[model samples]
Target chain A: MKFNNRNVHLGMNVRLGNNVRIGDNTTIYDNVAIGDNTIIANDCVIGEPSWEYYRHGENYTQPETVIGASALIRSHTILYAGSSFGENFTTGHRVTIRENCRFGRDCQVGTLTNIQGDVTFGDYCKMHSNVLIAEFSTIGNHVFIYPFTVFTNDTHPPSNHYKGPTIGDYSVITVHCIILPAVKIGTHCLVGANSVVNKDLPDFSFAVGSPAKIMRDVRELGGGGLYPWVYNFERGMPWQGIGFDVWSQQQ
Target chain B: MKFNNRNVHLGMNVRLGNNVRIGDNTTIYDNVAIGDNTIIANDCVIGEPSWEYYRHGENYTQPETVIGASALIRSHTILYAGSSFGENFTTGHRVTIRENCRFGRDCQVGTLTNIQGDVTFGDYCKMHSNVLIAEFSTIGNHVFIYPFTVFTNDTHPPSNHYKGPTIGDYSVITVHCIILPAVKIGTHCLVGANSVVNKDLPDFSFAVGSPAKIMRDVRELGGGGLYPWVYNFERGMPWQGIGFDVWSQQQ
Candidate 1:
């Protein structure tokens, strides 16, 4: 393992596997475990205290962050305390994964993406650049989210109760889509660009526009044929193919 | 030039003009040049390799990133190889500009904005937070793009053909507007918030709604009078406006 500077702080009981690289000024707190071949870039803050607090100035307990094998966390990314990631977790620059976030294997998060506290993602979930997944969101496997998509959790201002949306498996959300609080998007659904998803979506539905309505089914337009790249991730070869495949897939 | 640590790598033949201040953990690669009085914040990776490659495993040649005078690059921003900028390039946090991107003088890119490879922007172009400019996009001078705007480059999936939209000078794209590929947005046009731009817009037109159509001429509502802040950028003071100019532009 290579440490670019001695100023890098590794707290008590922190375990790092073989060939792990921690860059300059990176601070990993206590009880954090990073698996093998994981590269944590410069100035990243891992296992920071959570932002959950009570109205009376009390704070919630902070938990440990566990990163699985072959994870590549880029520079300036912040992983709040209590976050856990599966194997082959990769993120672009300035990504923020908040406290109590759980991710499955081979999930790729793009640059400037923020997953707020209590978010859960299944395997091979890819999010494009500048995406915001609010707290308590649950995403199933093979879900693809395009750029500037926002999953909002709050309905009323200053409300104590906040519930995020639940996305089913193989759902594709295009660019600049906004998913309202507590919305349930079913599997194999496609939400077009600039859509505002307010209600629930059925399986294999194609929805578009603000307050998005179902336009057609994926099976009607030849299912799985429109998105050949989704098959690559399903087959565990997430990084294969040309510019359309690699660059377009939030990697 | 102020280096936070001596371990910061300043590559060979890198010309840094006077009063250039680079923050901690910043790596400026070889052949990169920064003009006088530029401030690059922490954890920025300047002049990294481009994300372009051929089908036969051959990668595109990396190019130098040139920053003009009096620029301010905030934290966690990554400028890929083959990018060039004119004077006074001010950007918010975590902006990523890919390879072969070109920018003119006094351009302000807001936080979490990503300009994909081969994009071009003219002088006094101001893009708000979380904007995505896809590959081959061309933007003219004095263009103001609001938050969550996306310029798409691809129409059909799995096809090799890619083309981006061309936004003309003095145009204002309001928040959450999506410009589809190959569309031409004319000069002095105004696209309303959350509009989906699927076709071409004429000069001085005001467009709104999905599959954006021209509603009226911008000159009908008094040209340049509606946006007083555009004149502020034309002058030297980008941030010298009052509350109406600063707060209303975002909120």
Candidate 2:
């Protein structure tokens, strides 16, 4: 949608609408389209690393990345290869969204968060600072993650190996929680602070403690957990609320 | 000796002398001391865990840490239990001196550097930001370590395990170098940036490149390597015609 004075290589598949603004030290490579009212902030590295067919000892691979329109990617946020986001997305400083990841519309990511490749998120998701989302994770809509949470990618980890994790929509992962590799978290769930998740969580549940266990069910306890009461004292409003009416349903 | 309004406990065999100043939020437990003109800054935790002689069980183990005269321990610099420093020391923010270590006088440690336990440094040592000194290492006098250099503690490392590395002093370790553990570096050598030290280097030599090897000798190259060049540029002074006799060692 926008172009810097620096080098840019665009493909024929690229498209853009009006009033899109791009800042300094940003790179948006080929095969990307941006919608209207999108603002890509300063020092952002967007899109995939493109090259001709590679010959690595007679083996090779090919991949691509995409971005939806009206996505407000903030400063120093890196959207690596094979990653995609829906419209009206906003992310804070130093956020890394790795390759093959997808985000729903109006998603918000806080500062210094690291999101690994091949993860998918539903609409209106929110994540806080210093959070790590490992590869192949799935997150549903209306999810909230607090600061300093880490998600792993390898269940059986030999050093430097990566697999992935999974998280469903409408989930609230609290501050300082660590989700171990290959763990799957269900939808409409609440994970307390400083908890370590090592296994699967049931849907519509509330989980807590060091190694997380289900405290109660969300539908039985209430539609939403006690998060609204506890987070009322947090300083400064990050955002008000997201309109979920126009969100597209995933097949 | 120094004592402020913070919580402090002095154990047996602790020592102290004249002209010491301690700041707020400092906790000084057993087996430590203050030398003359030594000013410890705010929010410091000094001294080691004390030995407790129990009615039963094996003998308790605790080591002592000492601070020398005219030493300037700055704010948030933590001297962990079982560490000591000689006279005329200055340290920057959040510098960590781990247990069982010793340092000679006139050593300047830069911000966020970690000096592990059981390490020793000679006099007139200068270290820059984010440098890591491994355990059981020894450094000689007049040594200069640049920013972001890492000295390892184990040659054969198992993920979170710690071993030790050794170094001879009067050496200049450049920025962003990685010194593998258990390797010994000799005295009066110059190590370049981004180099990885794998084996022992001889004294009075220059080493560079990954898996560093000896390139030149500092004695033959003369003029104290590149320090004078950087110092002249930093001080806005000309390189030539400056008499060394007029330059006082004390600032």
Candidate 3:
């Protein structure tokens, strides 16, 4: 369909609230629900087709997708069936939240990030660009995931095999890091950049290196150093946004 | 730096053309050049601090970034130092084009995709979301790089060290595919999803499996079969800026 056409082929089960502005070339399919003040950007596809696993052919169930009020989903994003976002959540472009995933309120998911199926993100979580949170993962409040990080769903993943994985909450996964499947990261933990996490991380700790060793304790890094000396130029000086002179000196 | 502040900075050495629109909170640093009809969405970081790369002590060089005419870079994307785009090039959200890469006309780089330095993409290339293209690579015309694909710079990379890789034109690098560096992909090639390629691909061949083998020649798949039925779907529908019903299949 053309870009500004919203009233096309919508399902009867779809519901949208007031001030909900959708962008060009967006498709909101059947069986979707969105709340008020939720602005969706251009070229997004909500409620795409999905498959359900069945031991027998007759037993299959497809789930519904939902989004809460004031949530901002940007352009080219795909929200599959059985996926959802909570209130005041803001995501950068092209984020793919897979089926059966749930995100809590005020979550800032970065662009090009993928939160796989059966994953749950807690409130106020901020994830940077190019992060991959695999299936069955659990993310806690105020968790931060940096750019170019990856989380796997299977430790022994054969090529062309599909398996499930899991993770814990309140953790910070740093840049270019990789986490193996079924390894649970505890709450308030920190994972350093370029590390390969093959084991479970303990709570309130800092982990680094390949196979990710737990290095310094959390208290040593001062509460895991969520806010470091390097002011995130990303958050402060956005594209076309203004700068703070106070923080510019530190850079 | 607040998001909506108006006293934004566009550097003096930057060259901007007509109809080049920038979004809020974006910073285009000095010595940058942007072309006409380029639309950059919100919260993007265009230029870097300087052209100086640190290698131990002394050697440093600086180069400016250039965005060509009709290039559309979406929100939260970063075009780092010495990157350039050709006409009608588009990229998805939170994407990062690292240093010293260039694109030809009508290229589409997907959301959260990361293109490392010294790469070249030819005309009408399309890349899906969350892909990683490492340094010193080359892409040909009408190429399609799928989502979650990764290209490494070296075959036997000195574990965590940098290496250079390359790809030829008109190749299809499928989803979740990883290419080890120093490996060259030939022209008109098709790489299957989730395959790890460690060697060079022959021209007009379809390679698949781990350490990808040449499964079929392109001439074989091009024959009139069930494959021909699927190729029509591979041609994505165009987005004409109008109302619906002219393009909707339902109508």
Candidate 4:
């Protein structure tokens, strides 16, 4: 609905729901379904053909891509084929999401962030600007990744081995941190900025510094670092103006 | 110079040198000049009117933007007004360069890079993907900034103060490092990955760790940390297959 459609190119079998606004010069490729009230900004490429298109040029077949209701894709963003997002998915400007990525409801990816192929994120995850997620990353619900935080998939790069770090629910990874390959971070953990996570972190841990050491439980930090930050913080979240428990019961 | 001019908006008094190739859907505003053999890729916005455009919309007047010969601007780049670059300048995908930025000859900026306004770079400067250069950053010649490295101009953010880092010649800032406001790094320095630079570093220093410590002289690290790396490494540089001494002498 209300789509200007100037210079917009849509391939065969593309479906858009009600009240959708597609901006100028946007391209939505074949076999992509976007749900209601979605706003795709200018110069965006949805359901891009990825590597097959690179190798075969114009002769490549398209893969099925799906986005649930109320998605907001920003300008110049590129979303490759075979990715699925639940309702209320949003992204910042010039973000790149590679093939086969999956995200649950109410996920927000910030500007210039890169998500490599086969990444999975649970509900209510947030990633800030310039974040890098390597292939095969598994992130649980309510995960918050700050700016320039990187998740690696290779222990020794240029080798065949690939095992991305697995982050448990309600964890927060701060800015400039590098999570080593295959590291396991438990729920309710807080990773300090610029830290190098080389080993597994336990639940509710507050890790800081290079080769991060657990300082204390995250809940120990008053005025901040509360358990399930969703309960404490409510600036722009869905439960804003209402308690998280109250909001969840209604849901 | 041949221009197809499809869906391209050209403002008044725009100048182009010979052998220039501008891709589709590009917008070049007024008072701009591009040099010979420059290739600006698709969906680029050259001389974007920035803050005035936001306040005034279509009534905004653009400032003068100039680029020298053989520049390659890749896809979806937005270069604001009043920026100038010397010859052999290139950029990667989705770069956002703000107003009043200046770059010398043979500069290569990588993908998803964000260069804030009033930044200056000397000759042969290379910044890899996902780099962030804040306002007032002054970088000297032959600097290599790796991925996700950031420079901040604010000592205390959200305040009135501003002082960006000044990097001397032949410095290497590695991945995921954060250069704090007003930091002065001397020539032939090596800032290791994941470092946080808060103070001034003398010449030939090799700094590492958060609140970076000067570990050793840069020349001490073999196979790397060499002064004027242009002489030691020459795979893709203009001096490739020829020694830097020979190349400089010939020049």
Candidate 5:
């Protein structure tokens, strides 16, 4: 009850790599393969039972869930079955990820962020707190999203159809922005805070306002316009101190 | 363990009313008083210990927590010590309320919302999903806040100075909006979606856009505007079918 390290309830065929640390009241379901040096905190549910299991109960089979090397999953997080992540995936408190999601290396999902099922995320994506990505969102690499951003899939209310927004690589969606259904944002675009994006934005666009209008090229912006954060702002970024020029060359 | 009814871990001097049903793995801390017919679902923490308890451990005394009759708190919610709620309070999953917050009757909080400490709310307040209210927020009666809206108390980040926004009666703040510190929104105001409100808005104003502009009087808007939501849109409101005029006359 002290929130100390407790032996969690693990199902069959669960393979955990070396030096994995799991905290109190954490439950890992069957067929979950967690890589080396990963730390999962208290009250987490990895490979949580999916929708079918709820209806079928004990007859359901939980699908595979994989978390790659050096991942740090924080407290009160819930990752549903059939999701997979690459190396160094991280999450803050109370995050929720549904089934059939894929993530690349070095992704950081912030507190209270909810990713609905069937989403794909590329490497080094940072989704800060309270970000909600509805079903079928496809995110490219090095994308940064600020708090209270919503990627809505259903354009019409109470409809079965969903068309989640897609963001290309190295783009930054600022705080309190809403990306409407089926909107595709090109690479290296900067979406300013409190903007409502209703249409497709071309590459390198600096967009703002409700029903966002592109003002200019993102490269013309003062502090942002990302490619390794546009070689301008790199505080706490993955490739910090080691220059983007050198980093891109290596990649 | 199944998420069935279970006796939670309770501290000394705890009290519960008749027919109060509790679900699995909920832990209620010291001096908590839960009123009659209240149903708390699984994995909740009622009367969670305060910051001093975390800092000082056993020496810290938890303040008295109270929840009035017919409150329904869902799974994975955490209500910190010294908070109080009036009758018919409800919550969706994974909500967190910090210390010293007060809520009046018929307040409904949606999923993944986090209310920081020292906030006060009047009757019939509804906060939809993923809303974050920072410290010292004051909300009046019949306030409706939509998803992904944020109430920020700090004008400058990482600074000591804090001033949470105050909202008057029957105000509806729409989705993906950010209310900046020290801003006051007057009664019957309608805040449009994806807006960044930095200035004080007068009564009955329909505000929209970044650095939100007052479009017109809220009563002029087609579907929305308060005083029973302007008697236009009243879907699922408390005074539904009974009629607001009849309800208000009775009150």
Candidate 6:
């Protein structure tokens, strides 16, 4: 059930699994592998050349892009070479996933989000619209990011060394927040809207405001609970229908 | 005269004015009206079903999307049903205008900007790339918003009532500013970059910082001046015939 529309270009050694739908004018370049039940929407440029330029106009040879099963990639997305995604990866329109990135299972990225090169995301991470995760960032499992958030990687532009932020498991970053370069947010932390995180935040903290200060512990906050999706995955991936009852109960 | 491609899907009762160009794989749904000299780029999804779903499985039946004359909707834009745009409307690539949104004449929305449902914009509003205007917001005439600005519509999530911010005429909101819900920014105000706007700002004020405070009047600022495009519009939409003079002068 592979439907390759007109003007779709598949490069050398590209492997697409069963029930894969490739839309018109979409280009999946060399060494890419897309798993079963994946839909790559129209005008997407998957496995494009990496944006890694070395000294004196030299470019790094990008590795292949590997996409797992049940992925829904919306229109106009540009997934550069050397990126990998696990099962159940969903993205809204015009997402840009750059080179050398790894996304774990059940990751949902919203519209216009740009994950720069060399980023890593653990399972069940959700990023809302218009977010930017800079290069070399590491996000743990069950992380939720709201709209218009930015994670900086370089303190100064054109620096030789760039170190992005690190977020532990179950961290929540609210709308319009900016995490500066090399910042670390520990597990189960909640960063409030319009905040700027410049330092390290401890586990189970509720941080708010510009230059985000730890307000209180997560236990002190009402309506704070573990992500329902994680609970479903614990039972066995509910998206795959193994734990539908557990997922529905949470909903 | 409508020029439909092999893969273009024009719905029933859709009206296209003279000299309209729609690119390949574009879908214009039922009751959409496009005026003369409009260009809709490739892979666009025009008049798509709105994301206005209510509890108990009820959904809002969106009205027709209407576009005025001399518009340029770039590639991969998703203009939902019930949105109305005035003359000379220009949008960058992959823009998303939700249902029931009203954009005035000469409005320019940049790439990846999302205008949520029920938003209203006055004439000549220019929003830069990656902006998010939440639902129910009102922007007055000659408003210029820089990149990555977020307008919050609700103080708390899942609240029954939501109220967005009000931006007055000739105001300029710089990059990475977040305007809180129900806040009012007065006419001709200038909000600086990376600021969090939590309170009402007076007319002609220049505000900055977290919980943005008014530093001085905009007139006192060195670079304070009307947007160059306004000068061209005053000269009777010179962009149509002035041979890029108005456009290049600004650059």
**Between candidates 1 and 6, which one is better according to TM-score?**
1
| Candidate 4 local lDDT, residue B186 | 98
Lowest-sum lDDT 10-residue window in model 2 chain B: B48-57
By lDDT, the better pick of 1 and 6 is 6
Kindly list the per-residue Cα lDDT of model 3 for residues A174-243, writing each as its tens digit.
Answer: 8877666667777767788767677777777689975579887766675543433223233422211433
True-contact fraction per candidate equals: 0.40, 0.00, 0.00, 0.08, 0.20, 0.24
Q: What DockQ do the predictions score, one after another?
A: 0.31, 0.02, 0.02, 0.09, 0.14, 0.20
How should the candidates be ordered by lDDT, best one leading?
4, 5, 6, 1, 3, 2
Q: Over the stretch B75-180, how does candidate 4's per-residue lDDT look in tens digits?
A: 6788988999999898867888999999999998877889999999998888867889999999998888867889999998789999999999878887788999
Candidate models: Cα lDDT each: 0.80, 0.66, 0.69, 0.85, 0.84, 0.81
Best prediction by DockQ: 1
Top-TM-score candidate index: 1
What TM-score would candidate 2 get against the native? Answer: 0.45
Candidate 4 has a DockQ of 0.09
CAPRI rating of model 5: incorrect
Q: Cα lDDT for residue A200, model 1?
A: 96
Query: Can you write out model 5's per-residue Cα lDDT over B104-175, one digit (the tens) per residue?
Result: 999999778899999999988888778899899999988888778899998889899999999998898877
| Weakest ten-residue segment in model 1 chain A by summed lDDT | A228-237
lDDT (10s digit) by residue, model 6, range B1-251: 33458577776678999999998777776779999999988778887654331111134454789999999999778898898999999999879888899998999999979888899999888999979998899999878999888998756432335799999987889998889889999987889998888899988888998878899887767665543234324433334555345654865
Classified by CAPRI criteria, candidate 1 counts as acceptable
lDDT of 6 at A102: 96
**Which candidate wins on lDDT?**
4
TM-score of each: 0.81, 0.45, 0.51, 0.68, 0.68, 0.75
Backbone clashes for every candidate come to 1, 11, 16, 0, 1, 0
B1-251 per-residue lDDT for model 3 (tens digits): 01233334686688889957775456787678889877766557887533455452245544778888877776567888787787877876678888878888788886678888788887778886688898877777667776578888755545666665566765777656788877878876777545778888888768876678898876577352322112332343232343223434543
The 10 consecutive residues of candidate 4 chain B with the worst lDDT sum are B222-231
Query: Which consecutive 10 residues in model 5 chain B have the weakest lDDT in total?
Result: B224-233
Tens digits of lDDT, candidate 4, A71-111? 99998798888999889999998898888999999999999
Q: Cα deviation in Å at residue B195, candidate 4?
A: 4.3
